[model samples]
Target: MQTDSKWGIYEPEKACPNDWDLFQSYCYYFSVDESNWTDSKSSCQNQESMLAEVVSTEQLAFLTTKAGEYGSKFYFLGGSDIVTEGEWIWTTSRTNFTVTNWTPSAPSDDKGKENCLEMRKGAGYQWNDVHCDKNKTYICQRPLL
Candidate 1:
């Protein structure tokens, strides 16, 4: 993969497909329109991909920059507590949360209705928990193929 010296920005390589941005060993798709969490997840699946999984702080930063490039207000993450409250997991990777990059007073689950994760522009692209039904732009990811 043609990545930067810091491995932050990944340029398209011979193996990379069109319309997908390469980052490390993964390819990501950022949606242009807003959709709810469930529908967003479905969209990714339809594209033979899954909602993005932020595996580390570095990856989170990289994702934050990607989301900003789309100029969207918010972007849905692959994490949710729909299965079990307060227990977030990447639906695609089936990985449990270890470290999160929340802005401040985030993941608040205000009024106890929040269950889905999103990176918000207002919060400097930090992850936040919001109601799953709320519409937002989303990111889809899949292994480099």
Candidate 2:
């Protein structure tokens, strides 16, 4: 059997770089460099991946555990309501986000200015709505192919 992902179809037996971490059915790269959401996405794109998408609490937990070592900082996620505020969607996955781990009172949209989604270490890696222009570290992910 085969599976289809945002990156199209691929086999799962292949390996990612020795430096990259493999979790579940995907390969992840946690970037230490800080950049605005757009630049972060671009950086991931250059690496043939996209800003990490939180598909499940288990995956989010894995990312959070790895992220803690890098220090507390916001990390761009693959979600945004930039197209229409309040309508969040994963830009890379092109699917409506069915699950999320947000801190209490989050996604407030902050005066209706925030459109991008980021994971805040201080909030225990819960999702936070932020301005797309805010500079932050980021994570990238691709199917394990």
Backbone clashes under 3 angstroms, per model: 0, 0
- Candidate 2 yields a Cα-based lDDT of 0.87
Query: Candidate 1: lDDT of 40?
Result: 99
lDDT of each: 0.86, 0.87
User: Which regions of candidate 2 are displaced past 4 Å?
Assistant: 1-13
Q: Judging by TM-score against the true structure, name the best candidate.
A: 2
Which pairs clash in model 2?
Answer: none
Pairs that collide in candidate 1 are none
Deviation (Å) of 95 in candidate 2:
1.0
10 residues in a row with least lDDT, candidate 1? 11-20
